[model samples]
Target: MAIDDAISFKKLEVFLAFMKLNNMARVSELLGVSTVSVHRSLHSLEEAMRCPLFKREGRSLIPLQAAYTFAEFAQRAVEECEHGILKVRETAGFNAKRLKIGSLYSLTLRCIPQLMIGLKLRKPVLDIDLTLGSNRDLLQQLADGKLDAIVIGVHTKSEFHDALDPELLSIPLFDDDIFLAAPLNSPYSGQTQINLTDLHQEKFVTLADGFVTSQDFWYCFEKAGFSPNISMRVQDIFSLINLVSGGIGYSLLPGRVAKFSSQIELIPLESNYGAQQRITLLLPKIRERDPNLLALTAECRMYGRHDGKKDGFL
Candidate 1:
C-alpha cells in the first residue's frame, strides 16, 4: 500500500505527541482532542504502519522498539513537509526573506542608492527589491500591501509636520531645496539666482500630473504670479532632465536631482519660489516593528542625519 494513501499525517502527529508525552490525557490536551480520540489516532497510526507501536503495562502504553524507529522517520517527514510549505510560501511572496522598497525614480540617483548601501552593511544577507515610480503610484502600492515601505518627497514646512493617512507612519529623511534646471548654455544658467518671473516667456518640460514634483513645478509658477508655458510632459524625471539638457525647455525640480547630469545647470530661485521639499520614509503603522523594516528605517534615518550635515539629503 502507498504510504500517502494508507497513513494519515494527522494520526502520525498524535502518535508522535503521545510517544513524547507518554500520557494519553496530555497528548489529547496538546492536540486539543479528547483522550479517547488520542487513543484512536495512535491505534490508527499503528494499523497503517502494519506494526505494533505500543505495549500495555498496568494501564500505561509503553513504546515498542518499532515505535522508536518509526518515530524517527515520522519526525523527519513532518519537518520536511513543514519546510516545503515554507519554501512554497517564500517563492510566492507570501512569506518572504527579501525586503521590498518603493520610491520615486529620482531618488535612485542618490538617496535610494545610499540607503541600500547602508542597509547592506548592517544586514549583509538581506536582499532588497527597489521599485521606482511616481509618488502617487508608490503610495497606492504601499496602501495595497504591494510594497514594504516608500520614500518620497513631501511639502516642506518649518514644523516638519506631514499630513498622511492615520494607518501609515512616516519618518522625515531630509529637506531638499527646490531649484530650476536649465540648459547649460541658457542665459539663466549663468545667473547665481534666477527669478521665477524671468522664465515667463520660456517654455518648460516637466513630469506628468501624477508626480509630486509636477504639482510643485506648477505651484512655483503660480506663486511667482505667472503661468509656465509648458512645452512637454514626460513620465520620468531623468527624461525630463535630458529634455532640458537638449535645450527643449527649463524645468523646476528638487535639489537632489541636480547631481544626475552635468548638461543642465541647477539654478536657485528667489525666496518667493524657493521652498525646501521634505523627503520621508512611509510604511504601514502595523508593520512598524517588523525587523527588516525597522532596520531599514533606522539606516535611512541615520543616513539622513549624517548626509544632511554634509552634502545634504541622502
Candidate 2:
C-alpha cells in the first residue's frame, strides 16, 4: 500500500498479460483468475508504479507507452525464472536416480569393496555409481554436486579440517595403522613393534605427492626425526605393499591393505599406529533431506574392523 514498498512481481505479471491481451475477460480465463481479480492486480500495479498503465479508449482498454515498454522486460524476467525452476527439477530427478559416490583410490582397493558389498545386501535399490580419486578431488566433486558422498582415509587432525565443512557431514568408520611393512623374512619381521631407530637405515617405498595417506607417512618420519631413504615412489597403496612383498623396499601403510596379500608382514610402530590412520564416511550438507545418504552413512559405521596384530602379525 505504501509507495516505498516493493512492487509484487505477481501483480506485474498479471498487468503485463492484461496489457498484451487488452481484454480483462480473456486474460482472466487464460490466467485462471476471475476478471475482477485480474483488474484489481493491474490497477494495483499501475498505482504501485505511480503511472497509468492503460487509458480508456472508446469501449476497449488501450495500453500506455510505459505499459508496452514494461511488457518486454517482464517477459524476459519471467522466462528466466521459469527456466531456473525447470533446471532445478531436472537436477533433482537425476540425483534421485543415481547415487554418485567417490572413494579414495586407496580405499577403493579394499575398504570401498566391503562398503559396497555391505551396502548392496542392505540396499539393493541403491543405484551406486562409484568414482575413484584422491580425497581432495572427491571433496571438490561433492561440493560441485557431482558426488553425493565420499569415503576416504582420515589422518590425525585431518578429519576435522576444511574437508568436513558445516555443509558436509562425516563419521569415522574404521582405522588402519601406519604399520612398518617389511618382507616376511626380514630381520625386523619378528619384532612386534618396529622402533624409529630400526627404520633409520631401511629403504622406504612411499606414495607419490597429493595422496592423503602420504601425509601420515611422511609426517610420521618427520616426527621420528629422520626421513627414511627413498627406494621407490608409487601412487597406489596396493602397489607399495606389493613392492614390500617383493623385498624391493620397506614402507609405512595402513594395516587393512596388508590383508589383501600374504607375502608381506606388518610391524606396529613402537608409537601408536592405528591412532594415525582413520577412515571416515562423508556426505554433503544438503537440507533437502536425502534418506539414501543417511542410510549409507549408517552402514559404514556398522562394518567392523580388525584390531592391530589381531592376526598374529604383531
Candidate 3:
C-alpha cells in the first residue's frame, strides 16, 4: 500500500498482459508462448506482497487491487538504476601524469637542458616539468614535495646538510672552483694565477641574493680577509657574464660557467685565495640506486670538465 511495495518492471509487464488478456494461456501465447513462465511471474508477484494478486475464476486469472498499485511506479525505479551507473564513469577520466623537477637558474640554462635532452632521447614518453629557482629556494621546494629533486652546490657544513636525511647522497659532479673572471685582455688577465688577498680592491659583480653561489662567493672573500667590492647585483649568470665581457665589473663564477665568454679571463685562485668548491649532485640517499637518477648523474660527470685548454684559466 506504500512506495516500498513497488515491483520490478518485468513483473509489472506480466501483470499488464494478464489484465489485458484475462487468460494465462493467451497471455503466454501473445508474449512468446511460455505458459509455465507466466505462472511463475504471477506467483512471485503474490509472494512479494504476502497476498494473492489473482485467483482462478472460470479458468481465467484476475488481477487484485494491489497489482494496479505496484505497476504504477515500476518504470521509475528502473530509470533511477540506469542513472547511477552514468555518474561513476564521468569521474574516472580526469587525472593526468607528469613529473616536476627543480633546479638552479644556472643549471637550467646548460647542465639540466643537456641532461633532459639525453633523457628524452632515451625515454621520450616521460612527461617532465622543470622549475627554475635559486638554489636555496629549489632545495626548500624539494623538501616540501613541490619538486622531486634539485641540483646545487654541496657543502658539508652547509645549513642543508643538517636538514637532509641520514642517507642523503652527494655525487661529485665537477669541480666548480670559484674564479675571478676579468676582461680577457685586461691587465689583470696576464697574471699566471691570482691570490685571493691581492684582489681585495677589485670590483665585484655578484649574483643577487638567494643564490647558493652568491653565498659561497662572499664566504670565500671573507676567508681571504677582504669584503667584496660588490658593484652590482644580477639575477642570471648569463647576463652577468655578458656584462663582464664588456668590462663593466669583474665577477666570481664557477669554472664551467666561466666558459660563457672567450673574452673573459678565468683566474683560478691560489689556496690562500680560498678553499676549492666541489660541485656535487645531491639527492636522497634512497634514490642513489635509481637507474634514471644514477644515469643522469653520470651524464653530469661526462660534461663536467673545464679543460684548462679552453683559455688556460688554471
Candidate 4:
C-alpha cells in the first residue's frame, strides 16, 4: 500500500525517538518539542503507515511487535539517508571534518598560529590542512576551490582588490604597515624612519612577482619615482627575510614580520611611500555557514577586536 501524505522524514525521526524512548514526555524532551507534539507525530505516523505500531495504555504508548520489526527498516532508512547527505556534502567540500586553509607564509610567524590554536579549541576534531603561498597563488587556489579559505594581505590601492571574486566573502582582520626591512647593523637601522627615496639606490631582496609584498615593494618604489636596485628575488617571504637578515639587501616587508627574526629590524617608511597591508580572511560566501569557517571567522573577529591592544604588528 502507498504511504499517506503525512509520512515524512521528520515524522519518521519522531517515530524512531518514540519507539526508542517509549515515553512521550521523554521523546518530547529528546526532540525539544511539546509532549503533545510528540503524541501527535506518533499518531500521524501510525495513520500514515496504516498500522497499529503502538498499543496505547492510557497516556503511555507501548510498541507492538510490528513497531519493533518496522523500526529496523526505519533505522536503516534514516542511517542511509544520513550517509547519503554526508556524501553529498563531502563532494561539495562542505561540513567535512577536514578544513583546507591557505595562507601567506609571512603570517605563520604569529597570526596563523594564534588563529589555528583558537580554531582548534573551538573544533578539536577538525583536521586543518594548511597551504602557504603568495597572495596571488592563494587567491587563485581559493577561486578554483582548491582551498576552502585563505588569510592574505591586500594593499589598499592594489589590483588584488579587483581580483577578488564577488562570490567570495572578505573579513578584514588587521592592517599591517609595510616597513623597510634592514639588517641589525645596517646604516639605516638606528634611524627613526627611512624615506623610500633614500632607498632608491639601496640593493634589495624581494619576494617574486606574485606576492603582495612584491606588489607593495614595487608600488612604494613607483611612488618614490625610481626603481630599487633589486639584488635578488625569492619565492617565499622567509627566504626574502633571510636574505635581508644576512645583509644581502634591504626589502620592503610587512611589519608583521618584525617578530619573525631578531636579526632583522622593520623601519617605518616615509608616509608618501607607505602602504598598509590589510590582512583579511576570505571564504566562499556559499560556505559561510560551514561550522569550520564559522569558527575561523569568529576567531578572526576576536583577533581584529583585540588587535590594537597588542604590542607588535600581529
Off by over 4 Å in 4: 1-82, 307-314
lDDT per model vs. reference:
0.83, 0.73, 0.67, 0.86
lDDT of 3 by residue, 7-50 (tens): 56676677777776778889898888599988888888777767
Error of 1 at 192 (Å): 2.3
Better of 2 and 4 by lDDT: 4
How do the residues 1-314 of candidate 1 rate in per-residue lDDT, one tens digit apiece?
A: 56745477888798899879999999988989999998888877778787798898988889999999999999999999999987875654443578889998888866788899988887888889999999889989998878989998877753434456779888888878878898887887578788899779999999998787887887788789988898899999889999999999989988877678888888888888877777889988877877778888898789877874433423
| Better-scoring candidate (lDDT), 2 or 3 | 2
- For each candidate in turn, the TM-score is 0.69, 0.66, 0.59, 0.74
Number of the top TM-score candidate: 4
TM-score for candidate 2, residues paired by index: 0.66
Q: CA shift at 158, candidate 2, in angstroms?
A: 6.8
- Cα RMSDs, all models: 7.3, 8.0, 14.4, 4.4
Off by over 4 Å in 3: 1-97, 108-110, 156-167, 285-314
Best by lDDT: 4
What is the per-residue lDDT of model 2 for residues 123-142, given as tens digits with 9 covering 90 to 100? Answer: 77778899987767877888
- Give each model's clash number: 1, 1, 0, 0
